[model samples]
Target: MSVEPLQRSAVAKDEQWNLQHIYATAKQWEDDYRRAGSLIDQVAGYKDRIDSASALLAFLEQEEELGFLYEKLFVYASLKLDEDTRVTEHQARVDRARSLGVKISSATSFFRPYLLSLDKQTLDGYIAQEQGLEYFKKELYDQFKYKPHVLSKDKEEVLSQLGEVISAPKTIFGMINNADIQFGEVTNEQGEKVALTRGMYMRILEGRDRERRREAFKAYYKPYVGLKNTIASTLAASVKNNVLFSRMRGYDSPLHRSLFADDVPVSLYDNLLQTTREHIAPLHRYMAYRKQKLNVDELRLYDLSVPLVDDCEVSIPYEQAYETMLAGLAPLGGEYLDILRKAKTAGWIDVREKQGKRSGAYCWGPYGTHPYVLLNYNDTLDSMFTLAHEMGHALHSYLSDANQPRISAQYKIFVAEVASTVNETLLIRHLLKETTDEPFRRYLLNHFIDTIKGTFFSQVMFAEFEKLVHERAMNGEALTADAFSEIYEALFTAYNGELVALDPEVKYGWSRIPHFYNAFYVYKYATGIASAVSIAGRILEGDEETTKAYMTFLKSGGSEPPLELLRGVGVDLLKPEPIRDLLSLFDDLVRQLEEL
Candidate 1:
């Protein structure tokens, strides 16, 4: 008899997230949903009337209340759906919530145009007259920064109405990736051919068996390769749509528009790409080291993932992983640890793999509730590091929510990866320091080196790929599947150096990245790691001032721009030093591994 993967229903109650924290029952969800619907009406009622200071304040307050209700409703529904995606009832709830979300967007689209309509003098006079505007003053004034980009009210509403249609490419790609794509089969331990899964694919990549790694790599890419043209069309449409909006909004380019919200300059993006390429030698040396250590004739892309240190695996249970993570992160101090500890038992984590559960992991929750993490914990060392990474995001959310008001509590996407990387950095450093076993020490170093390779180097490569594709599209070139593959292969060659041999499947890598649909978002992953290296290093060195600043940085949230927040935490990413230092550190780790 075939033993099926455990379904979510059979999972232990304690291993699940208590989504009831947001709603007691389906009835409560319906009540909130109806309330949000009425609130949409109430918010729309104040539309053109938000001319006076008092009227604006009242409108803002009402919108905030509606936002709070809407988030609770949407988040609960979405989380339930993710628990077991096959459930139609939960899917319907999410659809209802999303429908409500779209309405909310349509109703509020007028506010930005209206706010931008006022002259500085008029807005200042209004703020001066109303004490109630104090809470919203910063956010209010911040709208002026987008004055150049804000469309007229009619245009704004039209754009808002077209939001779903405009976002169809991303939605289509997501469905193709998550719901429809299929991988080929691989020979399992039982000598039977089993369909390859994402989890199994990653594990196989890290396995000692070269044949298995090669087989799994081909299997994983089989579906992507087959549907390459379809995926390419989706990505092209997404890019062109971004360029269209950028042109419509009077921005210089799509890249500029992405950075405009965070007040980031074009130079910052360009600098990261150029600087990494300048310092690419260390990565080349490391790639050569991988080839030498693996004793493979040619280091194929598939060969790059298996552990350099073999036969050094450790089985860490979930409970032990949590404890070790707490220990690794203890440098953040008792207060941070206290909250991390509480999250383990407080229904803030969904920590198991089950049939129909969402694949991969993320930290998500609406404001007014603790952050929830969805993890498929498989008792591996990587799983332990994942626990550290996600909880870092969780506490960042928790601290920010507790400290800032609803308007500013949500951090920008640019800084979202920093706190998580800091946790990963610290955890690896702690593990490195504690292990005296030469092989395990080398393994830790290799693991950390590979993390940097994936997170920092590869991301910069992807970012540059984005810039090139978007630039080509902006210049009126066709973004074909072959074009994407050529660009990606060249980048893969440049970034990974000439040491690794390319397989036919390597160029098609771009077809699998979900982030490409999001447009100019992956560059932050590189910047985030640079900042985290500095902050984690200081914290590990007992720099109390930096720790305090980082805590404050977490709490400040989107109240300030991401660059300024990193500056406060003692990392100026605009300068060449942070990236250079991170590269040098990567070099040092690789050299240490070579010595070991």
Candidate 2:
């Protein structure tokens, strides 16, 4: 069946996210937009006077208010824009929101430097003396922690003014990927010309028909291949920007700067890479098994994603996916499950794909409002898992917002993926236990194996690639399209060995990865699954104390550092044990698959 893309209006109201919850109408959003500008000005007035405890408390409260309002404005415009990228009006709203964000940043640029100028004792006294200042103690301490990197007020203002300019690389990449580039159409096994998209590409790759998979693979990369140089240039600019900013901030490298922000030690990243390399054999074994199971002449790059157990058919609609997710997450207790139910019925999710919508799934919203998830759900088992995954993020946000203050509600990227993957780990465990049929059980087992491969192993590979590219860029190596492809190809070869054939077009795969733009962000996905696997296992074993501790960790949000947060939940990323244990689990799963 050829899939016809729907327009925004064609999507059912229940299927769509209610952005109106943020603002009832466009005029309301506009009103808040203008009001936010005034709030920024109001916040700027207390800049020089924040040295006193009372003034500092007032500043903190006003600042939080301003941030809350700004989030509502920004998320509304962004959610509207993502609903359909082609709409000029929505695009304008996004631009307006972004501009206002820059203005707010520039206006409040003095906060950091001014706060740092005060003595530590004075700041400590303020936190101890003022009731309101207690809420932002962590926020204040983080400023002092980065004191060496804090620039002069004038320089800080200048940097803040350039926020929009610095964001150009990511903006350009989004424009080209979501708006300009096109993948054209491909004929599927149904003998119909179906439109190929980023979302559809994954579905096609999983199809049993090799020819269609091959065709879709080739067509999908066609546009990216043609624009490789342009995309590469944009990516290069992003790296350079990261390097420049890191250098300006007195950091040795971009990796240090990024990790520093989250309070993650460099050793943690190194440990993950080293441990994953040592455990690469199981991944290679899985690849060989995949080839044998498919009975293919050669397992090419495109064949990697095709289903291993072809006879077991599992199709879950959206409503059923919700029910499945709720049941899967019941281990978290009734409170967590109730929140999940509310998220589904409320306007917390935009659940369908339409023309010009952003690809993939994500959870986004400000502190004041509920977290809204954007998913291009395709009704596949994978899509159902995606629903489970994103709901994890939403629930994490929901719980954090309810428990923590506005300043601490937004979790850091380092620990962000844990909640989502924990949901997935539990879901897969539930499915495996619930099913009695042999083939379906095998399918669930294979899914678990594949999840580890994609989430843990593949992410490590990408992290290695990202680390290499950033090092080269920092060392003044020019990053061109060919250079990027060569680096990725070398890493692919080292990781896969002779188990899978590396098609030439697979080298261009680096150009299409959106995470590359975010600079050293992929490694956390590996660490996240590692922690989640351990955490989920404990919950499934009926460890009530562990479950309570995990809930507390989720509610803590950014109140503490990510490392401490994970430690609170009994999964320490600083040591190599979690990674080793996860690898052991992967080995066992691969062995089980072999037996089956």
Best by lDDT: 1
| lDDT (CA) per prediction | 0.91, 0.87
Model 2 poorest 10 in a row by lDDT: 1-10
* RMSD, candidate 1, Å: 3.5
Q: Clashing residue pairs in candidate 2, if any?
A: none
lDDT of 1 at 30: 89
What is candidate 1's lDDT per residue for 474-495, written digit by digit as tens? 9999999999999999999999
| Per-residue lDDT of model 2, residues 485-521, tens digit only | 9998988877876877877788988898888888888
For each candidate, what TM-score against the reference?
0.89, 0.84
Error of 2 at 399 (Å): 1.8
